[model samples]
Target chain A: MSKVRFGVIVFPGSNCDRDCYYVLKDLLQVKVDYIWHQEEKPKGFDCLILPGGFSYGDYLRCGAIARFSPVMEFVQDFAEQGGLVLGICNGFQILLECGLLPGAMLRNQGLKFVCQFIYVRVDNNQIPFTGAAQPGQVLQLPVKHNEGNYYVEEETLKEMKRRGQIVLRYSTKEGVVTREANPNGALDNIAGICNERKNVFGLMPHPENSSEPILGSQDGLLIFKSMLQYMEDGEFRYGGGEEFRYEEGREDDLDA
Target chain B: MKRVLVYVTPKKGILDPAGQATQRALQSLGYHEVEEVKIGKYIQLTIQDNNFSESSIKEMCSRLLANPVIEDYHYEVSDV
Candidate 1:
């Protein structure tokens, strides 16, 4: 298999860009490059990553201002074209603001910045991002954010569950999905999800931070390794076949 | 100039930790009669164009000033 080329987008305030680049380039021995936020083109990359950080100083909202960055337009197009895109932490917020992913993030339920290693159970291993793990595999990843609570309409949540779009959920070390184990009070204890096509993935955890044993856990490496396996096997499914239709509801009538 | 004051708030039913915290603080401060509290963003923009229509202002609110997924926004436009 050919080397998988990964592009890590670097927003002005993105602090985890180097971490992702290092994991892909040095640790995983893959081809990776940094894409600046001002760049309007994301050409010739097999995978694109939006690292975690307080982009645009978290102005207006966590990712509201950064959503309009020049690079995000390209990222959207890339995702629509069936390119693999992973958004982590602040990156997840940007993906939500850009409409690439469903739902929105709210301030932590406790109204505080949460920074610690939390467990997330793999809800679906069929998707490219989690293909390396078992269906109920548990991973310990570091989640650090002030606004990480995920919310969606009840109907949308139902649809997401039906379609297996809910990729990861906050869970106990024993893989129990319980409200008591929820770190940020996310809806259904969701920690990560993918778009309908499963090509775009967004999660509030910092997988890059825990990708090595020296970081106290190598669980995060599974996600990246899964992507590599998917690429090597040439079984990447392009989501462009079906028309992307979000379930219509009262929420869609907001602009009407 | 036309000044537009945009108010952006989390949609009803959405959990707002900041607003909840504020409400708790108010309750602790002896405001027992307060039913609820909601926190939101107030953005004031001065546009130089006099031809800006209400529809366009509403469009702006929906497109950039607010996230329709979790927020609702309304604006008042008036001559400065």
Candidate 2:
């Protein structure tokens, strides 16, 4: 089979460029390249990963300025053409700011920058990234962010659900990962989401951290594996896992 | 002329560890009467037309200014 080419974007303040670089090269055994955020566009690659880090010092707000980067124009164009893309943590925030994703991430409700390995359930395994995994599988992954809260309105949330855009959720206290397990306390306990087309995926958790047992657990490898499978199969398999439960009193919305 | 007041708040499901920590700080400062505190942003904008509608501004809130799901926004428009 031909090798898959992957690219990682490096913004001015991105700290995880190398980590993401090493993982895609060593673990996935794919051709990986680092494109600076200031570049005019993403080079030819089948997949793109936006690693997590504080971009532009998280100034103004998380990912506010990075969205306007020159590189993102190309990245957006790539995604619009059905290429696969993944954004982790701040990258996820940038994707939202760029309107590549549906929702927004706010400051941690606790108002603290949290850094730890949290367990998340793979809720939607039908996408190209998570398609091979079974629903309700819990994967312990590292999430480091001060602003990782996801917000969307009820109607839009419903649309995302109908479209199978939600891909992961927090693991419940009982060790089951489901949409209801919202570990970060996100809306629908969503840990990750994809665009309507499912080729663009964004999540706060760092699967690259858990790709190997020495690093943590191999739980996150499935995400990449699933993507590879999609490249081969051209289709995804779906199973309805836990029912989505939107927390009551989650009526809080933002306008500025 | 018209003006609109916009309020931004964190959605309920997301963790607000910072707000909770500040509330704890306020309690230890001898202000024991405070029950809860939520941090948010507020902005006021003036428009040239009185016909400026809430839906138009709400579009701005959803598209660029705010994330409506985790954050709730409330606005009051006044005609000058």
For model 1, the superposed segments whose C-alpha errors exceed 4 Å read A236-256, B49-51
Model 2 CA lDDT for position A139: 78
TM-scores, each model vs. reference = 0.92, 0.76
> Mind giving the per-residue lDDT tens digits that candidate 2 earns over A167-251?
7777654555454344455776778999988899999998887888898677788887777777656565543444334454444
Off by over 4 Å in 2: A172-183, A234-256, B1-38, B41-80
lDDT of each residue in B26-78, candidate 2, tens digit only: 99998889988778778788998946877899987776566554567788888
lDDT tens per residue, model 1, A109-140? 98779999999988778788988787678999
Best by DockQ: 1
Cα-based lDDT at residue B79, candidate 2: 81
TM-score of 2: 0.76
Pairs that collide in candidate 1 are none
lDDT for predicted candidate 2 compared with the true structure: 0.77
Query: lDDT per prediction?
Result: 0.88, 0.77
